[model samples]
Target chain A: MMTTPSSITSNELNFLVYRYLQESGFTHAAFALGYEAGINKTSIDGNLIPPGALITFVQKGLHYVELEANLESEKFDGDDDFSFLQPLDLITKDVSELQ
Target chain B: MMTTPSSITSNELNFLVYRYLQESGFTHAAFALGYEAGINKTSIDGNLIPPGALITFVQKGLHYVELEANLESEKFDGDDDFSFLQPLDLITKDVSELQ
Candidate 1:
């Protein structure tokens, strides 16, 4: 019954990815991504987010989307057959397509 | 060049997943998964793992696999066109298959 927050902007997501890359020690990759995404322009404080937050949020979002899809289709019988989603698929695909 | 630790066992992974579910407030799901995975029998100290550790480890592992793929194929020319893998895919698929 967890709901995905509607307020998260693409910029925020980009920042999170940037921070995640940095925290994970992917310095070159982080630099490239941050430069392309203009992460420096964002005002969000990087310190506020703990390490591993991006993946955590994405995982939770995927779960919520799956739950929503199951609920809408009336297929959630507690069978625990939830299909795990790729992070990009969860972000890009429609909920109906996921089901 | 972070190498995936060979020391991590399936029991450790299961424990991490259980902890993740519990930390995310999916109490019933956590209980079910814990029961099925025999999480209580594991000696891993749950308190030592921070929130989001499971997803973080999985994400890092995926990245390492991707990097290894690129290196082995000699296709890594500093271009950042890495394909993101599903968490389950990372866990289930062999490295060669991922590429």
Candidate 2:
């Protein structure tokens, strides 16, 4: 079965969610985490990477690192409603911390 | 005790997070919940409302509703890293749903 993509985008809404995260304060938590992937391994540097992908940081940016060789590459194109489950189901393997 | 407010806002980052949620498919989950607050109670309508505030939907919009009368009035404002803690902490009382 296939679901059609519904077009939903707004500059205002985008600003709101980002501002929500900024107020909550979990931006630098990537390196603080220890995953089966790697404690030293990172991919999200305040940039919301796709789930199961390594979220790492650099001096200049917050980037998403995908280790395709070590990871199961599922065909998920673009960020859409399917992403709601990613942080919990796919991204953050360490659930207790997110709680 | 207080932390200084830092200025961090970006059009690109904001769009990224919003697109992430769209891919995950949680936009319409607001009214489907049963909370101690109220099963009929709704505040979030695809739009990310601030924690502890009521998020409601209307015919034309996704809006945030604040009920100061029945809720504890916390003095913190704006969305930040503080928001990363919201979905699991303040907004979602039903831990099982989020977990």
Q: In DockQ terms, which candidate is top?
A: 2
Q: Candidate 1's error at A74, in angstroms?
A: 1.7
What DockQ does each listed candidate score? 0.02, 0.03
- Badly placed stretches (over 4 Å) of model 2 are A1-99, B1-9, B28-99
Best by lDDT: 1
- Write model 2 residue lDDT over B1-99, tens digit each, in one string: 111121112322232333344343433221111221132333223333222111111101110111111122233333222111221121222222222
Tens-digit lDDT track for model 1 on B18-74? 565566455554555555557788776665556765554444444544445545545
Report every candidate's CA lDDT.
0.52, 0.23
Candidate 2 lDDT by residue in tens digits, A8-75? 13322222333343343423221121221132333223333222111111100110111211122233
Return the lDDT, model 2, position A80: 26
Q: What is the alpha-carbon lDDT of model 1 when measured against the actual structure? A: 0.52
Model 2's DockQ score: 0.03
Per-residue lDDT tens digits of candidate 1, residues A14-92? 5665565566555554555565567788877666555765555444444444444555555635544545554334333
TM-scores of all predicted structures: 0.39, 0.17
Which ten residues in a row are the worst by lDDT in model 2 chain B?
A: B56-65
True contacts kept of 1: 0.00
